[model samples]
Structures are given as C-alpha cells and as structure tokens.
Target: MWLPPSPGQIPFQQGIEAVSERFIGAPFIDNALGEGPGSHDPDPTFRLDAFDCTTFIETVWAMSLAPEPKEHWTDHLQKIRYLNGEIAFTQRLHFISLDWMPYHEKRGAIVDVTRDPGLPLAESLTTIDRKAWYSKMHPAKLREFESRFPADKPIPAFMHYLTFQELLDNPQGLNRLRQELQKGVLLANFIRPNWDTIKYIGTRIDVSHQGFLILKGDRIILRHASAVRGRVGDEDFVEYMKAYKEHATLKGIQLVRFKSL
Candidate 1:
C-alpha cells in the first residue's frame, strides 16, 4: 500500500518522486471510467487504490500540489482533471495534446515543450470527433451528452506528433529531448494507427498514455502505471522507446513540465 505525503512535505519534484516510488508494484486498474455509462457527470471521482495511466498521473499531480493530500486531493483533483475547475464530463480534459496540454499551459500548470525548434518535425491535426461519438451513445446518454456539448457545435482540437522514422533520424534532436526529461515532467505517449477506431472508442486525443519522468544520475526513467506490466513500474526511457518501436501503432512522444505555482 502506497501512502502520499502532505503538500510542502517536500518540493514538487521530491513530492512526485515520493508518491511515484511509493506506488511501485501497485496494481494497474482500468477504472477511470468505472463510474460507467450514466454516471458521466464529474463529482470529484478518483481512487488511489488502483489506477489507469491517466488517473495515475493525475493522482500524483494532485498529491504533489495539495497542502494536505488526504484532505485536499479531491479539490486539487477536480481542478487539475477538469477545465476551469468545472466538474462536467464535457469539461474534463479528454485529449492530451488537444485539450489537456494547452489548457494546463495557459493556466501555468504545465509548460509544453513539444515544439521546441531542435526536436524532430511534427505533424499536427485535430481528431477524435466528440460529436460523432456522442451520436452513437444510448439515447438517454445522448441527451445528457447533448446538454453538455451541443451537437451542432464543433469543438476545436489539435495534436502534434512525430513519426518513429523521424525520431530515429534525428539523433541531435533526440538528444535534446533526452536533456529535457527532468523529474516531474509529464511525458505523453502518442500512438499512431487507426485513428477512426481510437477516436470512436478511446480518449478523443492523439495521446494514448502518460507518465512522469524521473532522472536519476545519468539515466532517465519513466514512472508510470503500466497496463502491460500490470502494475506501476519504472522503465528506462531509452528501452521504453525502443520497445514501442516494435509496435506498429506507436508514433512518438509529447512532453509537459509541471511548474510550481
């Protein structure tokens, strides 16, 4: 069982390290959506006992920021999990690049350095049609979705991503990316494959997963809730990237650095 420290018990970097380390070997549970079909409305829902990739990162972030995590994590979770601190499924950040990254940047919660000039060239686009997904929802849920997101409206969403070939070709740029992988920075996994299926059933975003960067001495490690490994674990960054290269669905990565407010 992992226990989180109170906010200010240490700096954000140390706080993230403490929480992530404590959660190592914790079971990976796909329960972020466990509230299920009709329970889409936001209500400070989170579970530290188990986590998916997104919830794992969100939980650690909330724990790091709150003065007393046990007492204030719910409020911090709400603020970080939803846009403008509005508790609606529609307002929740559904896309990493399109919704979460930029919103957090604007709020000074994070700094997105994915487009730094030295990195590999990236392809940018909007995806995951929320309206399209809503259309197929059960009529009852459809009404709820519509009330939050008007069907006639188009939501502006976008993503920036690099292909595996680009990453392999840009050694110097890859070095730059490695240099930027500091403790507490959030690393988003951008998977490339059938966008239609992903957009329809998955998170309406280019990013498929996320984790925190933990640089120990000269090595960079990713502290994440791994569904494949079935628990929270630390993976060497380089090895993790190479493993993804074998997967046809993998694209590349996007990074967000969380700064203390």
Candidate 2:
C-alpha cells in the first residue's frame, strides 16, 4: 500500500481511510468548528468528539495530512477550511462548488474528476449572491459575516457533473464511476436544482452531501457523518444512489480526489 510521509501513520488518501475508519460511530453535530482563540464563531476550533458532514471530512483529511508524533491537525484544517488559511468565519469556504473545491484545486491540493468518470458529462450552474443570501440568515450568523459578504451580483459557475439518470442508464458511465470509487476517489453527490430560489443558506451550493467512496473487492462503501443517522456511518453507495433517485433535487455525483494530502 502506498503511504504518505507521516512516520507510522497513514497521511494521505490511504491515511484518510485509516483515520476516518476509527470514527465510524462518532456523533454528528452541525456547524461544529469555531475560532477558539482569536475570532468569532463560538464552536470549538477543533474537536474529534463530534462532526457535521463538512467537519467530518475536514477533520479526517487534516488528520491524514498532518505530520504524526505532533497532533497539529488543526493547522492543516485551517488551510483546508479557509481561503488562504484564514481562520475568520467569512473567509471560510462555505460554498462547496464556488469556494471550497476551486480554491483547493488551484493550490494543487485536489483535482476535480467529475467528468473523467463518465461520458455525456453535464454541468450545474449556480448563482452566488452573498449579500442577498446573508440578508436572510439568522441575526447572529449574519452579524459574523456582514462585514465580509461579497457583492450581490450574480456570479454564475458551471460545475462539471454526471447526471444521475444518465449514469444509471449508461452502463459505460456507471462502470467508470465505479472504477473511480475503486481507485479511491471521493464522491460528492449533489442536490439542488438549477435556478433554485429557495433559501437554504447564505451561499448557493451544488452539493448537499459529500462522502468518501471506498471500494473493497466488489463491495463499495460510503463513509460519512449523517445527522439522520445520528452518527458517522458507512453505507452501501449503490443503495444510497438508489435512494437519491427519489430525491427532488439530487443532480448527480461529482468525483474529487486529494492530490497533495
């Protein structure tokens, strides 16, 4: 097995699996992280006791990437969770399609292989209007971001994607996507309609859920923290996709992998 340079601990993608596997039954808490020492956001800056989906992935990846013998995972988490490693609330990569993936892609940290997994690739266009979005947020959350919210102008981005129906029908695409999972690519199953006007958050997001896709022999597993499940858990990815077929806005899955972890 290829291991990252972290002494005895796994520190990359393989390390990611090793690290996350230990938290299979951990509790899931929404909006978990906060600026503990020198900023706003009351939640603890770091903790392994509980996690939301985003925090779970952030914590796992950070732990996998950090050098061992000194548990400095938070340092890695800062860079992964924020723009330019800023710990402030506003600078955090709140939107997955707009801020999170793109920022890491540019830094050579990750690569978006959403299209490489299939034929007949598609796109998800989302308009990000930070000012208008924050206007609808709760008073306290808005107060934390009011000073740094971006302009209200529509910044439309086309996120490369694979259509769920197409992948379901296209044996070729289905096979390829499975191949990617077998290769250890993380899968971000997107949910949210194009031109969606409903207020879900301050930033328009493409993916509503994300998880690591691990393949062992013929069995594929999805490891993630789910509030509905009330804990970090592993589920069959194919079954999960079948469930998403009944969802109103589940667009499809986006393929991503860490290149620098």
Candidate 3:
C-alpha cells in the first residue's frame, strides 16, 4: 500500500485552510494508510500526495485541531483514527457510526449535527459483526483481530440521517441543509445503501464515504478526494448529492463538525 516515495513532510501549518490548500489535488488511493513502522501495510502514518475519503478528513482535521499542527498532526491522527489513541490495528476506528463517530463524540472532539436540522430522520438498522468478519479474513488477519474485534461490543449500530426523499419532502429541512453546509469546518459522511451494498464482502456497514463541506460565497461545495474523479476536487453539494436519486448506494447524509480545542 506504500507509495513510490513520499515527498518531504508538510511544512508546519496552523489551520485547516493551510492544510486543505496543499491537498486539493491529491490522488484518491484506497488503503492509503498501512500499519507502517510496525505492522500490515507499509504506508506511513501520514502523507498528502494521496488520500481515501476518510483519510482526507482525518488528515485535514488533524491539522485543524492544533495551534501549530505540524508538530502534532501525527498524534492527532491517532486520536482521531483509534479509540483512546491506542496505536493498534485492532483499536483503529474501523466503522464510522459504531467506532469513529462515537469515540470522537465521547472525547468532545466532534459533535454530531445530523439531528440539528430537525428533518424527518430515520435510524439505520445495521448489524455490524466484525468478530465474525475478522474470522472470515485470511487466517493471519483473523488471528490479529477475531478475539479482540469490536472493542466496544454494543456495535450493531443505529444512526440517524436524512434520506433523499425525506430531504425533499421537508422544505424546512432543505433550508436547514443550506444553512448547515455554509458553516465551514464541517465534515459530511455519506451513509450507505439502505439495503445490501456490501453484502458481497460479508460485512454490514452504515457509512461509506465522507468529505469536508466547503461553502464559497453562495455556492455550497463538498470538497472531497473523489475516487470516481481520481483526484481531490470541489463538487457542488446539491449536484453531487443528486447521485442519491440516480443510485441507491447513497442512503443519507450525516454531518459532523469539530469543537474548539
């Protein structure tokens, strides 16, 4: 999973704007981070040349959390990526609703704003059995994760989000959506298909993708590293979300924003 040769470390930057500007054109590479320096994939703890959806948000948020982010981005990433900043593959926040979001929420790092709009929302019923999932992985992976998987065991997670039609039916919700998007430093996570989008993988999941919500003037934008577009770019929030109508893969939107540190 390692890249050919990463460039030098990013010069210390203070806020998300500085870090965001530098990663605007990064390529979207899946499994971009590996258990480097000790485990699984060889990729380093951080890099700007490439990012998957979650890593882009993690890296940018890491930079945004500190006064002099360059010095602390590494450890910040660990805090965001793993529960209690435990540096282990098993402790990594693998599931968004179950592990990532709740861990951050408990620590006062981010506040889930999915319910802030007061839209007609519904809770997703997802059965997450990572212990079973790890058991099915290659023997070596099962050994590392099976017994210790799903560190927080109550994780057949249920999350609230605004479905496409629900967003349309509530004009008040539509208006609130616009207002929420305009608030910068926002993170938008896309909940997955209502049915079985990942049944082939033998895992059930609620969240599938994420990006930063960026508003430029009156235009609301989702600044994300797009795998379909092959690079990081700004996409019109409404036009991009139109995929919800075209494909069932996009079930809903969950908004999260960082708290002042």
**Tens digit per residue, CA lDDT, model 3, 91-175:** 7787787788888888887899888877778778787766655555434576667467435343467788878667655667567
Per-candidate alpha-carbon RMSD to the true structure: 3.8, 4.6, 3.6
Error of 2 at 198 (Å): 3.6
Model 3 clash count equals 0
Candidate 3 collision pairs: none
Model 1 global lDDT (CA atoms, 0 to 1): 0.65
TM per model? Answer: 0.80, 0.86, 0.86
Order of the predicted models by lDDT, top scorer first: 2, 3, 1
| Model 2 C-alpha lDDT per residue in residues 113-217, reported as the tens digit of each score | 876764787777887765556566645556556556533355776777777677777878557877887667474656564646546655565678778878866
Better of 1 and 3 by TM-score: 3
Off by over 4 Å in 3: 1-18, 146-154, 193-199
Range of the 10 consecutive residues with the lowest summed lDDT in candidate 2:
1-10
Residue 154 lDDT in model 2?
51
lDDT of 1 by residue, 43-118 (tens): 2286656678988888778777666645666677778878777766667776666567777888887876667636
